[model samples]
Target: MITIYDWFGYELPIKERYQLIKKVGFDGVLLWWSEGFGRNYYRDAPQIVREAGLFIENIHTPVQNQNHLWLDNLDGESLTDCYLQCVADCAEFEIPTMVVHLPSEDNPYNTLGLNRIKRIAEKAEQLGINVAFENLRNLANLAYVLKQVDSLRIGFCYDCGHHYHYYPDDDLLSMYGSRLMALHLHDIGGSYSQHQLPFDGPINWAAAMKKIAEKNYSGATAIEAMNWDYKHLSAEKFLQEAFERAKRLEALRLYNP
Candidate 1:
């Protein structure tokens, strides 16, 4: 079945957040590993999510400001170590996927960086976790790294808003297709990542959903949209509308198999 998941940021308390997500009709919640590690909030998150009766869709890893993981000449080793620990936590929580990112800017790939990815992929395979590389501004470089690694444990996480803003001309859904292990679904305005609800902005929601269905993507469609400018509506009202919108989008996966 196609799963509808929402992202869990450090917005509300863990219990409240997971409760709200469950009430909002999400099948699961995607945890942000960065916030958990940053605030040293590793222990309670999983228990709260489980008690709230929500499945952990995936855990998102950290992103760097400059010289991202797929690049070299920086302190990426520390980041890798953090991610490894995060993967171990995911294993303990029984989470199947972990979303990661490459660099956000144009940069040359480093051999050391590629080796680092390979090692991570190998570890994930051993631990039975899938590592999903998120699409950012540096699609070409990311493509190069994916080609080099070519590991089944390492797949793609297509972020709709990022693709619409950064690689506007590229048909990522078609390019990555079945290799997609996860999705960060959000809408965007012109040249900016609004992270708005699906169809609330300029993205062609129908066409994108059609592509996903055609590709037979069966992973969770996690909503990564945040409260950017929906302040006019009350939080409860906004969440209700978001759930309805997500349901409408979920309908596109009806025939997907």
Candidate 2:
């Protein structure tokens, strides 16, 4: 199925966003599981999306202060608790997967982070949910955390934009494709992590999709593109373009050999 993120740089009401997503021919949506946008929206988004007939693919946890998971302080401990709550929130909402980032910028991996991730994973396992750790600037930290936390609930969320901008040469799909549970498909060009629609940037979609198919990934073709660069278009027009790009990506993934 094809899915798009709910907040693609739109400031419309939450219900209107989901309706537009459904109206634009998307089968599902990726939600942000945080109150950073708004507390009522966070609490009501799952039902709102479902009412619009779009199944939620996954919910991305808050990224702010994610680096604290590695530090040796109360903040790290607090972060762990926050993640644990996120896992529970997934279960509460019946969302299957929760996407997370290991560290922001260049934070080093540490035992504290691993332990906290383990705690979050344990809760997810008990609640029958998946915790998908996403790739960021720190590849070593992602590698280390996935290796250290050996759980069925623990897996990877591949962000193609981050891959292209941060470590384009690294064959990340070949490395963690087996554990890939979710996707954050977007493009980057001219700047850092622009999150542009596919083909809008210079990323080789043919090559990326080929690698993803080679890994035997068969999950939702989900786009995390934002409207930062395409603000001139109306919301419906933006979603129409996103839906078309997603179909193009799926075609590449299926037809590439």
Candidate 3:
């Protein structure tokens, strides 16, 4: 079954987070595909998800940073060692992939960053783990980084909300469709707060989900909404929205052609 995954950062407790995911009918989650202000959720996460029979498809972790320590930095060969260790941990728990951010101009156009990521992919490959690269910040423009790396193990995590955030002109869905292995499905404001619900924002769900279906993507689509915690809403209310949107996508898939 094609399942929906969610990103529940440190906002909710780990035990409650798993129960909430099961309650919402999501088979799995993206595991912090977004930023974590503090603490590594993965440090003690897998056992919880497993008890609920929920799987974690991917865990997004920091690779490159500015003014902060970076994993794929140009100055050191050891940057990737840390990243590889994270990957190793993911593999041990049967997490499928580790979503990484591309190093930016902070490290120059040097292939060192790319090489480190490549080596990370190599480590993942040895362990049968997948490596996903996501669009972040201005570089959230992810196509070029994907193209530059051009490795199968290194694929794209299509963050729908991130794309809608700063670049409405770009068709990331088509640009990286073939390489898309995961998605961060959340709505963003046209002129207000991002990560709002589907109907709460100006995003065109029909068009967006249709594009995803067109690609025949076989990956997790996590509902990355904030401020609308699953525990607060009644099941009828939650599924009412989820089922309706899913049905809309189903309709578009068959009728549009």
- Candidate 2 structure quality by residue, lDDT tens digits, 1-257: 89998889868877888899999899999988777756456878888889999998899988888888998999988888888998898899999999988886578887767887888888999999999999988799889988888999999999999898899899998899999999999999734456999998889999999988888888999999998888799999999999999999999998986
The clash count for each model shown is 0, 0, 2
- Give the C-alpha miss distance for residue 114 in model 3, angstroms: 1.5
Better of 1 and 2 by lDDT: 2
What is the TM-score of candidate 1?
0.89
After superposition on all CA atoms, what RMSD does each candidate show versus the true structure?
2.7, 1.4, 4.0
Ten-residue segment with the worst summed lDDT in candidate 1? 1-10
Q: What's the lDDT of the predicted structure labeled candidate 1?
A: 0.74
lDDT of 3 by residue, 1-257 (tens): 22344443335676876777676566766665323555455566677877877888788775444212233445455546667887887778788888766554343434555566677878887888777767656353245557777667778887778788767788887878898877766678634456555566778877887898889876655565554544466534554465455445446544556
Inter-residue clash pairs, candidate 1? none
Query: How well is each residue in 1-257 modelled by candidate 1, as lDDT tens digits?
Result: 22343442235565676687778677777776665335467456778888888888888776643355654445677777767886787898898998887765566677887888888888998999998888888787678777898888888898888888888899987788768899888889623456787888988887787788787777766787766657666555666667777777778655433
Candidate 1: segments with Cα more than 4 A from true spot: 1-11, 36-39, 70-74, 190-192, 255-257
Worst-scoring 10-residue span by lDDT in model 2:
34-43
**TM-score attained by model 2:** 0.96
What RMSD value applies to candidate 1?
2.7
Candidate 3 at 218: error in angstroms?
1.3
